[model samples]
Target: MVVYLPSLTLFCDSLWTKKMCGAVVLFVFMCLTATTHADHHQPCHSPNMTGLMNVMSLKGDKIAQGTFAYDSMGKKLRFRSNESYPTNTSLGLDLLMLFEEGIFYEIDSKNQSCEKKKLQMLLHPLDIPDDSRFYTTMTAGSASIEGEGLKINIWTGSIPHMKGHYSMSVTMGCLPVSTFYFTETTTLLFSNMEVELEIKDPHLLVVPPFCHGEPVEDTPEGTVNSFLNEFM
Candidate 1:
């Protein structure tokens, strides 16, 4: 899904909330001395985990809340959007991307159907890109006491060959808190995230039995552009 905002482009892939390969631009007005730097936070990878994710398109005024699983070791990603506005856009959409097998499955539990397509891109690990520059460190929540807040690190960079820029925020522990993808006209925000170091339910990474033996077709459409239509 792509949501257009002034001077921003937010693109999200079905496999991972559609911001998979989008660019990132972070505009901060704090101290230059604090904003411009590189450090141990350069490229921190997230461990295999499952968590809740809230995806929002600023200009489009669309929102989808779902659970997502990231298994870096297995090179698999699964997301099931159980709630969404305008119901037909993403609600009840379950997607599984198997990078090792070079395939993806779109399972429709209501109809007991599945669409198997060849996965087109290489694995995009959940981590701060090596090229990312340290933007700044800030506190996440408002608190009366100076020390009573969550410390977060902001990183900024652009995806090579991709239009626009990207920004991501992670806790001091390197857990992803939110990510922003910006392009010429869209702004995509992935926020209200709760990530754990454990998969919680291993079954989420399993291919649904209904999708077994399903013929794999060439990618009918790019996963990044078909997010909104998946629910239809």
Candidate 2:
């Protein structure tokens, strides 16, 4: 089911000063302390799943918005976007990352050309992670209205390997709703998620025939974000 995250856009106004906005964001985080009796547990690590969702990433003044599908069990992710930002355009417009093979394919749909590159890093699944601290429990929408909302647990922590501070909202049933990730400069938000517990098609994870025989390019240095370290 599609989960709409309203919180991410609450402070997106350009009229506010950056320093003031930062303080407001910090205050919101400080207020979400976990209950004393609650267990600080991470979301379930589901090995098999594939679904599509909207993605928005902000790095400095640049913003990238798109939709992506992923197969956790197959260890693959594909992202597509209409207009691209410099932060993401470094790889390619349409990209596919295959973690198991340590490679990625940049597809040029118009020309049906695919460029391959070596993926230097391992895949980081969307799990909340063991180091994450439980923040609090809250509802996304009105529980009184049927089929409108679900209970979610909030979490925050730094991923030492990735060097980013992150906060995520996960359903009580272990599904992810939204995620916010930040480093010294960049900020990423993954919202409007719809995750399935099973793979929809095996071919979704397969490298297309057009990508075969393409010379692999060396991967450049990159930083970790919500998904891949450099290629998210």
Candidate 1 local lDDT, residue 21: 33
Model 2's alpha-carbon lDDT is: 0.58
Q: What is the TM-score of each candidate against the true structure?
A: 0.69, 0.66
Which 10-residue window of candidate 1 scores lowest in summed lDDT? 1-10
Q: Write the per-residue lDDT of candidate 2 for residues 109-180, one digit (tens) a residue.
A: 788788787755453435556566887786555556888656678778775655677778776766666677
Q: What TM-score does candidate 1 reach?
A: 0.69
Clashing pairs in 2: 223-229, 224-229
Which ten-residue region of model 2 has the weakest summed lDDT? 83-92
TM match of model 2 to true structure: 0.66
What ranges in model 1 sit over 4 Å off?
Answer: 1-40, 83-91, 122-126, 142-147, 160-162, 220-232
lDDT of each: 0.60, 0.58
